[model samples]
Target: MQKLSELDHQRRIRLVDLHEPQFERDYPHIDRNAALAALHGELPDGQVLKGLDTSHRAWSLVGRGWLTAPLRWPLLRLVADGCYRLFARHRYRISLWLTGRARCDGNRCGPKT
Candidate 1:
């Protein structure tokens, strides 16, 4: 499994913090279900918040409404085999969305507060 990078983990944490309240109110009954789903298996972003993996290449998992803010539904590894075919390659530049690496000049994707 690809290790979760600092930026990625932090991004998830931020998203979780923002959504915890909604979870409490709207899906109060499904907290257990959500946790269960995340733990039991990997799903698409549009399917659930957990398990879905992102890549510099293409979606390791993809769904119809996956790119939206509130992912509409959960999707599984339907995009894996040749999933890389879906997107243009993204040679991740720490400078593009992260910084402080040897390949970067500290120009962009600077340190977070």
Candidate 2:
């Protein structure tokens, strides 16, 4: 938690647990441009950053496969498949963290009500 606090303090990352009521209240007001700006600010000067994220659903598998279709000749599919299986089995929540698909139906993800 301390490390997370430090990271948040530095604006290196914004941690939002979907189950938090505050997120429900603040989601509508979060400015995507400002979030992008914060992300850029967290990086070192003169560095460039680009983000690519997708849902953890079946359709996204096709999207990812299509996006990397050009690299099939180099056996990249094996690597991508391995990563997908690993995350799906052990770190599925992390895989869907940004998408909020991992939120518990109950209050299990955050403080109990």
Candidate 3:
């Protein structure tokens, strides 16, 4: 497990403080099955909030050696694989967009489609 930089650590704390309350307000009735899917686990809402608070902090701290650590290597690989899958799914559309952007007069993506 890699350690977080001081700046990243502060950022994570601020983000958690900002978002934790929103999560509580947004999912007051988080026991509902519909809420379970959004919670990302079977844990109660408060626990879910805590997990998210930590997970998102970890996410923000990625790419600073943490991503390449033994514990996070597989997760990073999975993220890369997911990116490839997304590119495959939207390859043609992305290509078309790029092509249009290349031919744009300035930087307007080819006259707004």
The estimated TM-scores of all candidates read 0.21, 0.28, 0.25
Clashes of each: 4, 0, 0
Q: What is the C-alpha lDDT of each candidate?
A: 0.33, 0.39, 0.42
- Candidate 1 Cα errors over 4 Å, as ranges: 1-5, 9-23, 26-30, 39-50, 53-113
lDDT of 1 at 32: 47
Model 2: residue 53 alpha-carbon error in angstroms: 3.9
Candidate 2 — worst ten consecutive residues by lDDT sum? 50-59
Angstrom error of the Cα, residue 84, model 1: value is 20
Any residue pairs clashing in model 3, and if so which? Answer: none
Q: In candidate 3, what are the lDDT values of residues 15-84, reduced to their tens digit?
A: 2121344766765645433332232322333454422334443555553434334333566656754554
Q: Write the per-residue lDDT of candidate 1 for residues 73-101, one digit (tens) a residue.
A: 24425444233323212323424555534
Instruction: Name every residue pair that clashes in candidate 2.
Output: none
Candidate with maximal TM-score? 2
The full ranking of all candidates by TM-score, starting with the best, is: 2, 3, 1
Model 2, runs deviating above 4 Å: 1-9, 28-82, 85-107, 110-113
Best by lDDT: 3
The local distance difference test score of model 1 is 0.33
* Angstrom error at residue 39, model 3: 34
